[model samples]
Target chain A: MMSVGELLSQFGDKYLQALWTTYGLTVLCFAGALVLGIAITVMRICPIKPLQWFGDFYVQIFRNIPGAALLIVLVYALPYLRVMLSYYMCVLVAVTLIPSSFCSEYLMAGMNTIGAGQIEAARSLGMTFFQIVKNVVLPQALRSTVLQMTNLLVATMLTTALASQVPLNPADLTGIVTYINTHAVGGITAFMISAFFYAVTAVVIGQIGNRIDKKVRILR
Target chain B: MNGAHASIRDVLYDAPGPKAKRRIAFVTVISLLALAALLAAIVRRFYVTGQLDPKYWSIFLRYTTWRFIGRGLLGTLQVAAASSVLAFAAGMLLMMARVCRYRVLNAIATFIIELSRGIPTLLFIYFFFLLAPQFGLQLPSFWRITLPVSISAMGVTAEALRSGVNAVPRGQTEAAVSLGMRSASVFFKIVFPQGFRYVIPTLISEMVIVFKDTTYAYVVNYADLMQNAKVLISNYDALLAVYLVVAVIYIVINYLINKLAATVERRTRAAVAAAK
Candidate 1:
């Protein structure tokens, strides 16, 4: 078992690299989820019945499947069907798919808060369909979901822990803990160091989210 | 009508005029065809890749296979039930401490809640799986998964419970106090019960999360559904079929739990409205 000082001095560089990797994965996955989520939300609320059903089916499937299960299928099972993704790609796909479902749900909830009367008002002004969506629906939904998207960012970071399941070139934060524990008797200090990084990042995200939410929150 | 069930679907468009209806109908037909084409393409890929072979899927036809998966599901349910109970208890205690007038307790409780909620469950599981043993705390595999899962869940549960408590009208507490009731007794008998009732739906939804966390039981080598699915995979040499089926099983179970939560939420809303 390594002491706290010994652990940090010995593995300080790895911890920094792991933190960077975690940050990179979180950002990329979240960006992907947001784009995909917005598309799904559009499908869900669109007037086309089949597209709406497809969107609903997509959300239910992704939202209900466990992260580990999805990762395994993406990494292992997909190969059987001749659709092989790299380890990183599999992790990215799994992480993005799960959160996109949630992101869509939050967006829908935010959109629901915008009353029908507002749409009618927009229509009376001769706003085109796309114009109403862009000017009215999108702005309110995006603003109101600031906090939820913030939490989703944190959740995306956590989901990157799934990276530990696969062997990546530079492991993420969770993967580093596993790396250290296996190679050396890093003990509780190893776990604590990683946990500290996660907690601090989460706190920072929460504070920023609160500030933004306060600015943009609709009183109604 | 100014109904409460107004959703984004209602707000996205006005009632379609004649031309708009025709356009929608045309788009619907086009989308239906596109969706069918997509499905056919996927099946074509399966056929090309030989994934549609009977050998890949035939194990499901046997009753014994289901019994094994069912047994594993029972294990999953057991872990989920235990963790949910433990998390609920911890959450209640934390919520009470948070609301009470003790500064020290409040600070400590708040810290724990943040720590638990902020950190990922995998980190907690690693703490138990890897770190605890170094300190001579050797937990069984079951406890390894259950403890961390419950710990991860308790913080969110505490927040949910606190929200429910906040929703309870201040007048109710004041009314109880004016009736000469003690604080703790009043809380337990009057405030907490109503608060608990208010959050029943939220708690049930939280159970979906707890059940999902239990899927991490694989790390500790616990015989939850995923673990058992691994066993079946090894024995049958059918990775795609077994894993896909297992994933469906999880989705279905969670879907049902969500439906149950929605039903409870609707009924409670009605009951509360009727009471008003």
Candidate 2:
């Protein structure tokens, strides 16, 4: 019988590729979601009536939808609608949309926390609306948002495992995990190893988030 | 100054300005338009493509699929309830261990809480599903396997409680110890109540996490609502309708959870104030 470590060593190539794909897909989706988030938050706060309603509705709908259902809707439902996206694109849509909803809410929360006096000050100084938002509001929003964003990112990365449901089962950490569970015989050992890997990733994510939160608090 | 302030006006509500009104109206219109468009597109696509009947999901809902989804819903509640209670009890034990002053017990508790704090909660659950059976738990397939899953979860909740304990200002525990109270009594009576108040918000947040994360139980074929929804989507043609319904369910449950948490938070605050 092959030793457990030796058995694990054989799948190194597959494991490495899965790791890259997992991280790459996660970063791209999260970045896109952030843009969507910012747009929605801005619209919600806009002086224009229609834009604010659009933003509010978007948050309420997305917030209600479970992340898993959203994933399925994007992946399985869209194709049925004749939108022929590849599996990866489907996963991206689902992941990005969910985060966008959360990010918008977070941005709104951050914006609310900014003192109204700053905006009034900017207005009296004759700054244009854009200038006031850029100079006075954005900086404060960023301070609060940075920590919240980090927390969301960590959560998103963990949730990315749900992407394994895509038909392709791209060679990411989660995919590798499912593969090992089905193909390998070591049973709990395989599970433990994969979980350990995830736990390590989580630790790194948590540490990074905590540091940013601390830095922002110190700056304030 | 007294004469000038003599006639204070009574205010019931702050009136939003015209701009705020405009903003609200605009956002509402745009939002409805977008949702309507999404619904329309879904309907149109269903009509045109002909891959499956839009009525399949509705029919499914009326029959055996209904049972499956209902079962799945029960599963969702089961895992969430089990894990939350597990975390609470586990956390209490861990908190006790951390406070025990024995170096070994303290070390074990610290390591577990810190480790769990760093790891993603999803991975922790997945890990437990894989690892728990080895520990003789033999959880039914529906229980969502992996022994360490709840343990890790408990670890996080426990750590939250520890912080709650710390926030008790350090003197309360000391005061309890000096008043001829046993360690157990002091923990359950004096420290536990106060610590719970401080941690209630985080606890509620954790429950939300548990509720949402149970969806991950789908991957292992645990038949939670999410998995049931997916099976429904695949089995029928009313794809968007079924998915929409699923979304509403999550929102309703989550809203209730948040409301419950808020109620608890209020009671705690009232108690704190009353004590003061």
- Top-scoring candidate (TM-score): 1
Could you give candidate 1's per-residue lDDT for residues A84-167 as a string of tens digits? 899999999999999999999888878878878999999899897778878998889999999999999988998898898899
* RMSD after CA superposition, every candidate: 1.9, 6.0
Q: After superposition, how far is residue B86 of candidate 1 from its true place, in Å?
A: 0.7
Q: What TM-score quantifies how close candidate 1 is to the native fold?
A: 0.97
What's the C-alpha lDDT at position A202 in model 2? 64
Task: List candidate 2 segments past 4 Å from native.
Answer: A1-5, A218-220, B1-54, B57-68, B114-138, B145-152, B174-184, B227-240, B263-276
True lDDT of residue A20, candidate 2: 74
Residue lDDT tens for model 2, B17-40: 687578657767776688789878
Which docking class does model 2 fall in? acceptable
* Candidate 1, superposed: residue stretches over 4 Å from native: B1-6
